[model samples]
Target chain A: MKFGVVTFPGSNCDYDAYAAVRHILKEEVEFLWHKSEDLKGCDVVVLPGGFSYGDYLRAGAIARFSPIMNRVIKFASAGGMVIGICNGFQVLTESGLLPGALIRNTHLRFSCKFVNLKVENNATPYTSACRRGEIIRIPIAHGEGNYYNFVGDIKALEDSGRVVFRYVNSRGEAAIEANPNGSINNIAGIINEEGNVLGMMPHPERAVEDILGSADGLKVFESIRAACASLLNTVGGK
Target chain B: MNNDSKKAVVYVRLKDGVLDPQGITIQKALVQMGYKDFLSVRSGRFFELEIKADSADIDRKVDEICSKLLANPVIEKFEVEKK
Candidate 1:
């Protein structure tokens, strides 16, 4: 499976995600420049973490207007895999590929630390390898990771099982203390209705190695690879 | 004199139910400094835009910018004032 990592100006974690896929996951990976409209036929497109476009108007606000976003939207509309991490998550919401918006942390400070996340749902391609209610430690670094959705849409998201991950404690319980950024309902990650796209604030790529503190994040990448291969086999069998 | 140049101000604010952490922080700091007369606080942003009066439907254009770019309609509300 080919992975495409987008490199927007001010994107710092693009290489990290690229390295994780190419070296660790042993997959073909390419860097998709923000100005270019080509996805290079990648199976999965990753919008990595960073303060894209200096987060000028707002986090991921200006970057959403980049020329490549038009193609990204098209790719996602066709059931292509897309992962938006950190500021990438913000861009997803801004571009209307995902629901809800990320706002300022309730503490109004940049939080950088390892937090626990529970796999709220395991049916989506993104979290297929994760067991429901399993807790994984991942680092989050951002000032605007707080997730906010209206009460009505919140219910719809929950009812649809689109709430993929939530802040949790060591025992795999969603607790108030585990909520690092004050995100509503402690949402750490969510997938769109079609289950082709995932937008999350946690740095899963940053946690792909045990030397980096935890290797729990590797399962996320493995799940995608498994899902992609399964998809190819399903088509080949026809 | 040019007849096309005009000014428009866009005000962007978070919706009522959304929490304004920055504003709440500021309010707390004020209380610590002995200015506790305020009931609540909220934070927002504004932008000054210069547009062409001859452009097709300036109101519609400004509204589009506000909704699509200047303000996040999910958590924010925007107002465009024309002069």
Candidate 2:
């Protein structure tokens, strides 16, 4: 399956995302620039983490209006898979492809470190490779990773099983101490109502290899690959 | 003496019941340091502005800033106190 990673001007994680897909997962990966409107015939599109546009006007505010986002939104709406990591998640939220907004870290500082995340739900295409309640360690580097939505919207997300991950302690227990960025309900990641788009604060690309001290994040990519492959097979057969 | 001299203090804060992630993070750190007496914490932004516009105009300007730039109305509320 072909995987496409969008690169904005200041997107530093594009290479890492490409490396994880091309070298680690051994998938056909393409790097698409932010200005390009076309997704290059790829089934899965990834918005990797980084300080896009220097994060000048809010983390993902400026990047959301990029020309390529139009196509990305259409692609996602059409039931294609789209994943946004960190600032990518910010962009997705700003683009209205995902619910909620990313606010400044409650501590009002940039956080950079490894954090434990509990898989809240494994039914979505992004987390289907992992079992429910599994804990994975990933790195999160952001100044605005706190997620907030209306209480009613949050309840709907919880009811619909759209919450995919939550901050957790090393023991896999949910607690405020495990929350590095103060996301609501310790949310580390979430999916849209349609289940095709995912926006998460943690960077899976940085944790996909053993050399990175963890290969736990590989399952996220693997899950997307399997889901996209199944989708392609279904389309081909039809 | 300037007739239009006026000052306003703008207090921006997360709305009630909205999660203050940054504040929660700090509260946890403080607790780790054994400062357990703190019941809750919330962080906010404060801005003091001296403007020459009329009070009505100042109110409108403050609203513009709150809606467009200074504060995200989706999760925050801003109050302008005239001085």
Candidate 3:
């Protein structure tokens, strides 16, 4: 499957996503500049992490209006698969592809470290490779990863199993201390209601290599590959 | 050259139920400096915009920008004051 990694003005992790797909996943991937309106026929779109637009006005607020995001929004609405990491997650929330908003960290500091995330729901395409309740270690680096929304919306997200990942301790328990940015219910990631779009604060590309501290993040890409392959086969069979 | 400009100030604050870590930190600092009795604190930001006086429906335009770019409707509310 072809993957498109969007490169916004201040995007620093675009290469990470590109390399992970090209070298590690051995998939067809291309860089989609923010100014370009074309998606280049990519099956999946990856919005990499960085301080897009210098986090001006708000994190991901300005970048949300980039030309490519207009297409990304359309693509997402059409049920295309999209994965957003770190600041990319911020952009997704700002673009309204996902729900809620990421606010300032509860501790009022930038946190960068390896964090354990439990697979809250393995049913979605993003986490299908993960076993339910499995704990995966990934790196999270950000200052405004705190997630917030109305109490009712948060409850709805929980009730519907839209929460894909949750920060948790080593034992796979969601504990207050394990929440790096004070996200509600320790939400490390979530999938949109349609189940095609995913936004997560952790850097899965950064953790895909064993030398980088953890290889567990490869499961996410693997899950996407499996889902896409099955979908193609099902379509081609008809 | 015609110069008829008006300034509008937009203030954005997090919704009441949302947590404001920065505001809480500032409140703590106030207590540390030996100043108590401040029940609570909330932090917010503002933006200043200059619009042409001849612009029609300035309020609507300002409100549009506030909801679209200046503030996130899910977490923040913006107030615009024309001066």
Clashes of 1: 0
lDDT of 2 by residue, A1-238 (tens): 8999999999999999999999999999999999999899988999988888898756787787789888998999998899999999998988789988898777878999999999999998999899999999888899899888988988999898888999999899879899987787899999998889999999999999888978989999999988988887888922
User: For each prediction, how big is the interface RMSD?
Assistant: 0.6, 3.4, 0.6
Q: Which 10 successive residues of model 1 chain A have the least lDDT summed?
A: A229-238
Itemize residue pairs with steric clashes in candidate 2. A106-B21, A106-B22, A107-B22
Candidate 2: list runs displaced more than 4 Å.
B1-73, B76-83
lDDT of 2 by residue, B11-65 (tens): 8888898777668877888999999999788988788777775556667877787
What's the CA error at residue B69 for candidate 1, in Å?
Answer: 0.4
Q: For model 1, what is the C-alpha lDDT against the true structure?
A: 0.92
Candidate 3, which segments miss by more than 4 Å at Cα? none
RMSD of each: 1.6, 5.5, 1.6
TM-score for the A chain of candidate 3: 0.98
In the range A105-128, model 1's lDDT, one tens digit per residue, is: 988889999999999899988888
The lDDT of model 2 is 0.88
TM-score of chain B of each: 0.91, 0.76, 0.92
